[model samples]
Target: MKGLGPQIPTKAPPKQSPHFRLYARKYAKSNAWTLKVKNPEHSHDSIENIMVHPAFRKFNEQETSQTAQMSESLLMPRKIWAQLCSQRESDRPVILQYIYNQIKKVKKDKVQGRRPIDALIDTFKEENFVWSSERDA
Candidate 1:
């Protein structure tokens, strides 16, 4: 009679790379957007395949990259946002509102201030430009 065999620990398989996961998620979202916009009759797999073609793949990559950069900028910490608002007056109100909204979503207190539109006018000075005689005529 054989003694009890040594126990072997079983572990789950390693996860997929982050790049592949990002690619797959972006591809799925883009495919859905395309289907909605064009009302196509293709299956999900077929649409996914088409969307992964070299041309569409490159386009998707660029779009995803740009979106990532934009989100990173938009999600900067409050201190960073304040610094940016101080440096870029034109962007202050929009940036402030963005930060406020982010805070508000998590039920945090927000600094009460003027609306984004008011900030825009204050930042840009809407009525101070002088028009040329020819253009006015």
Candidate 2:
């Protein structure tokens, strides 16, 4: 015989949990569901937080491998190129001035159609050189 009351079922799980009543009471209205809506789109974390796209990463790897395969000595650094350019710029005016002076020094009519070597020979007179005299002949 049980106690004074009628016998109830043995221990079994009821449908609801202890917290369900409090949760249901807090969110009772149908409009409550609309207030607590969920976003469908979710974002995941990247490997190291440096989100480089796969295509760019592949291209970079290919470029690095190709460069490695070639002779590394041929690759000029930025500082060297900059120095070369600056040197050229500095010397350009001096070279141009020298060329200008040389052009001005040249006689126009005397050497107009003649080659440079021929014109230079013509500059000296024939009297400058004397033939050896045979007894002052």
lDDT of 2 by residue, 1-36 (tens): 667799877888673423211112245665453233
TM of each candidate vs. truth: 0.16, 0.17
**Model 1 misplacement above 4 A:** 1-76, 90-95, 100-137
Per-candidate RMSD, Å: 21.3, 35.0
- Which candidate leads the pack in lDDT? 1
What is the lDDT of every predicted structure here?
0.42, 0.39
**Number of the top TM-score candidate:** 2
Candidate 2 Cα errors over 4 Å, as ranges: 1-110, 130-137
Output the worst ten-in-a-row residue range by lDDT, candidate 2: 16-25
The total number of steric clashes, by the backbone 3 Å criterion, in model 2 comes to 0
Error of 1 at 55 (Å): 37
Model 1, TM vs. native: 0.16
